[model samples]
Target: MDIRVVACDIFGTTVDWYTGVAAQVAALLPEVDPGEFAARWRGEYAPSMDRVRTGEREWAYLDTLHRESLDGLLAGRPVDEPTRDRLVRAWHTLPAWPDSVPGLTRISAAHTTAALSNGGFALLTNLVKKAGLPFDCVLSAELAQAYKPDAAVYHRAAALLDVEPSQILMVAAHKWDLDGARAAGLRTAFVHRPREKGPRQEADRPEDVTADLHATDFEDLAGQLGSR
Candidate 1:
């Protein structure tokens, strides 16, 4: 493990987006099933980004895509425009998982820790500040004008950090993200978040993913990486 930088996926890997968004939805629309609403909203994430990635749509920040997806998901619902906007912005303040801050703090002591996410710079910065995540720097798909799983995003991070892809460890909970990073020649680590989608999530588990390292959470990941 000759990693100099630890590039982390922000959404499900470090922060609990599911819990954060679902809680906001439940607060604003008690009649709607918050869990289902959250899932549906998140399900739109990839396709919305894919539209831009494939050149079907021009480059749009993730915040724009999130708002668009929210509008579609809230159609026929009784939410007002202002309330909808607030709910959409909920993503900007997701809470870090219990071990996220500590783990990242420890890892940062040993390596340059950064956010390598699809989130826009503003959104990721806000989330990091609100969650108290200890990232040395923030890098986003928006910066590369491309989303993750695309080679451009990974390459951009390596370039910005002035490191070889092989010297950066891309840590994420999504196998597809790890696969993309690996394809781009970066080392990969999969951290399992069993309830990332919801309480009974049938999401990808560590056993289903192949990476340089697989761990139960950020704390476990820090330990495995020999971070003190």
Candidate 2:
């Protein structure tokens, strides 16, 4: 396939949300299990997005969804308004995985690189800048007013990048996301992120997905993509 653009999913695919949010949770709410809390908070992510996807509610950005989820998770806990807000902001400050910057840098040198995320534009901007991810562009669900796995989101990325969906490589650790992209006519790359959920928790494995390419990490993906 002639891939001219690489569009990547952000959260668990590039950044270590489990570790980052868990660390913040551990620091902010010492009494609770950080790992469990982080998982629970993330568990709310899809359902929250589904609400909007299914038209159960109006379009809301990831930060607003995160804050709502955090508030629900911290119910009856001692977390105050200020603490809750900080916890929500922790998503903005997440650290990229070891391979993210280097791999993205290499790929960006060869192809147009775009951050395709369910996150809001502002949220992605802050995170991408802070993480130093070498993406040529940032695309968000906010652009389509729809979340990922929605055909519209992937289509919007292709449109904004001025490429055919078939010419774009959609990369993500989650098979569901890849499936969505594939349905939208995009090529797919499944990058394994085994620790995204936590060490003890087994994340998406290669056997669990089917894609145009399967990689161990972003660096591996860059190599497979013929990136220097």
Clashes of each: 0, 0
Model 2 lDDT at residue 214:
96
The 10 consecutive residues of candidate 1 with the worst lDDT sum are 199-208
TM-score of each: 0.97, 0.98
- Tens digits of per-residue lDDT for model 1, 1-228: 689999999999999999999999999988888988898899999999989989999999888899999989878777798898889898999989999999999899999999999999999988998899999999989899999999999999999999999999999999989999999999999999888999756778878899999889888999998988
TM-score of model 1 (CA atoms): 0.97
lDDT of 2 by residue, 52-170 (tens): 99999999989899999888877787778898989999899899999999999999999999999999999999999999998898999999999999999999988888889999999
Error of 2 at 185 (Å): 0.8
Model 2 / residue 40 / CA error / Å: 1.2
TM-score of candidate 2 relative to the true fold: 0.98
